[model samples]
Target: MWSLTMRASTSVAPPGAKTTMTLIWRLGNSWALRGAAPATSRATAAAIRRFIPIIPLPVDGVGRPSLRFIGRNAFQKGPSTVSETENVFRPATPRPAHEGNGMPQSGRTDGPKDPYLLASLHRGLEVLDCFGARNSWSLADLSTHLGESKATIFRVLHTLEQFGYLAKDAATGRYAPGLGLHALGAAAVRHEQLRWQALPPLQDLAESTGETVHVGILHDGVVVTVQIVDGTRAVRMHSAVGKRSPAHASALGKVLMAYLPDGEVDAVIAAQGMARFTERTLTTPGGLREALHRARLDGYAQDEEEIEAGLRCLAAPITDHSGRPTAALAISAPASRMDPARVAALVPQVKATALRISRMLGSPSMAAA
Candidate 1:
């Protein structure tokens, strides 16, 4: 949306320079800004001419305003008021000629591939992307973050809420993902097949070991918990299906990273710094490298109070048909319950369960490495 402000010159106008400015806001997905400035002296007119902006200045990202400088001759001055119509819908970042059909990248590369793509749709999806950084957002916060007007954000929120993609809390005036989004998200997960394939074995392992079990995959240098079977014990690790944790601190993450090509481990370390969750958490790249080496040699990884002060874990890699370590299975228990003997016993169970899942995925040779 667009709003116009006037800084009138104290000098008198050409009798007709007295004009009113109108707010150009969002109407559905489109914007129509109607503006009129007074016809004044060349100096005064030039001073105020900048009030008419050409584009909605979205900060190359979340929110937006308008700040395009027009040439001095772009305005047409009538005897009374200066009138202009500015279009706010514009494409995103410019790309080389070959990168796109030029209809504008939807910002969401995985979204629909329709040729007649709508700018408003891309903007709506960008709103969704912001949630990745934080769980909930207020309308004002989103407007400030995205640099768009509250009116524009409200329309987008209203539309998203109508579709059940976003839920609003009447008490807090903040928005979070709704059940409809959850259903769509579950349907859209790339790990759906992996979760189903690993669930049975994971459940069996949890029952056999009386410890919590989790199957997680690496995403953006973080471990995303995909499948979980709570341990039968009264005091087991608490986890959820979509929880994410730092990679280098978790056994599941370390075991999976152990199978990556030589430099990728360092690359991940460089991209995502290994934050120390506990005193035992690996902080240096060298320490993590050695740990990963041991994970590779032993066919499993261990987390001895690395992720949590009193929780220990052992994880083994689950391979795909190509024998690629696509995921990892881990067993977790309280530190007091998992000493050397207990951990040694659980290691084999976790490995066997992971291997069973690997076999289910048609891994030809997920042999001990």
Candidate 2:
């Protein structure tokens, strides 16, 4: 229910002209009166104030105006120069939660009522949601999907492109998911409990072997390093956390690839070609298949200067509860420090650390194996 209050005042136009009366109307708590004239006669204004009536009206819809009071007593015997009018409606109150179909009672699903829900942001997320199986979207296609104007959709697309969440083609003007989104996905994958649980053991391994240790997971045919423990050696290998390397060239990558299904392995290899990083890097399909077979048989993989010259990496698979290789633990060192004999000695230690991590993940098959 809404209540209306009316105020009256008299103003003189000229010496010989008649008096003018101004009526100021205010609606409910949401609106206020503006441009009201000053009282000319206190007694007459008081009399007018006494007869002012507060009318109650029903609020039917959002931003809907109430009925105007047009009764006989709405105007009094006065002059005709009631100039200047200002009527501004306040923002309407949201209806009760139960009144709308599946509308949240709190005006928000996640938190308390927030009047300033940015529509542009909501629409931008909706635009991102349109890029699932299709992979790319044009302005017209996004506008059609979202039922928004082309101008609005263009602005949203440009903003997303600027932030690197979406990439736009210069010639085609189509947009796809960008590298920034993949970075965010990689960060999320690292945030899993396994990374934290493996930190202590990885650190211990690095200290024991005096070589850099890494924990990485497969993402989009690449191995993304989630955790890194630098070795105590002065000339140790240095790799950033979130660094990505080819699955066929790095030991961590090969171990992870070896455990995936045959079809998935073929797809990953197809998507990420076997680019030869070094002379020792496997470039042919048959060579990579043989290496993966050896990794599966030995429960570990080796990178003999495959990714980078003068560097070697040995990796063992860390399995999940389903015995799936969700991550790999690797130790990296200079070729001079990790010679064939040293690698052979450290292989058992790397496998033991990996098995401990798999056990921590509650892998029944790993426990049996």
Candidate 3:
């Protein structure tokens, strides 16, 4: 599974500068060979070329600043060398999907070991994985968690921080997911089918109800806003996509969680604790259990200022082909305008539009549910 190719280039050595051999090693979809031997002697250059095993390779590929690390570390210049660096293998810009949507997204090193896998890359990815379970990680926390030496973890974290995949605080030195990761996540979400199918209907719902609409999906036990449509009303929920919110505090989260089996529901609850956001927010498992049961039975979920004092939300599940709820369609409005009577009127509309979106997703069981 491994191959070696080598090439060299020639450049003029200035006065008192030692003759140098510039060698470039590239991997992935494209490769290059740049540098030259001392042009002082053609015979010497020919001798070097004969000894070198690498030749110029044909190039064909686009490139970007990929963060995956491979090759040798920076070395100090020796007596005979003016300046030199070891091989740096730069892969193609568009990384393969299995590596994780251009972020090379996964960092689990626990699986079956691959000899070719870079331990540093694996460790860095694992660091990224910790962020999903929680927001920030300190170097000590990661070092203890990974059972890696402090020096190794420090190097891994430093490398990732330099690449923009992880951000480190100046005073605290606590690390968090950076903008680079968010950008990659956005790129991946833009290609997801669920958001694509739900967009039109969600827009329509926002227009009809004159309320802000959100399409939320369950991620790591919390509700994440995937798509948002602004309402026509001047006073509306000013929301952004990709926001993570508590499951017990929002109708969107409750509706999405209702369809899960008890075991998975427990997992979600375990991962995302029931933190009370407002007086009405469900803090006890028993109360949230009841709410989820009500959601499954009624085909919808409601948040009566549970998450925010003046905002109310109603949500219905959007099922996939297997009839499992893959996402939730929800609308948020000011509580003053969403009285019991208006809620009753809006319930049918919310459920119907969610059903429509589910149908578009090839949900065979929406009618039966």
Put down candidate 1 lDDT per residue, 1-369, tens digits, no spaces: 233332323444343233333333233323233333446688865554454333212222211212232333332221122223233223333333433443333244333246787879877987888777778999997776666689999999999999999999999999999888898886455368788878898889888888999999998888999999999999999899999988899998899899998788878898899888889999998899999999999999989899889998889999887788889999988999999998887777888888899888778886443
Q: Tens digits of per-residue lDDT for model 2 on 29-81?
A: 22222223454698876765565432223222221222233333432322222
Off by over 4 Å in 3: 1-191, 367-369
Off by over 4 Å in 1: 1-190, 367-369
Worst 10 residues of 3 by lDDT: 75-84
Clashes of 1: 9
For each candidate, C-alpha RMSD in Å? 18.9, 18.8, 16.5
lDDT of 1 at 209: 84
lDDT of 3 by residue, 218-263 (tens): 8888889988899999899878988988888989989988888999
Q: How does model 2 fare in lDDT? A: 0.74
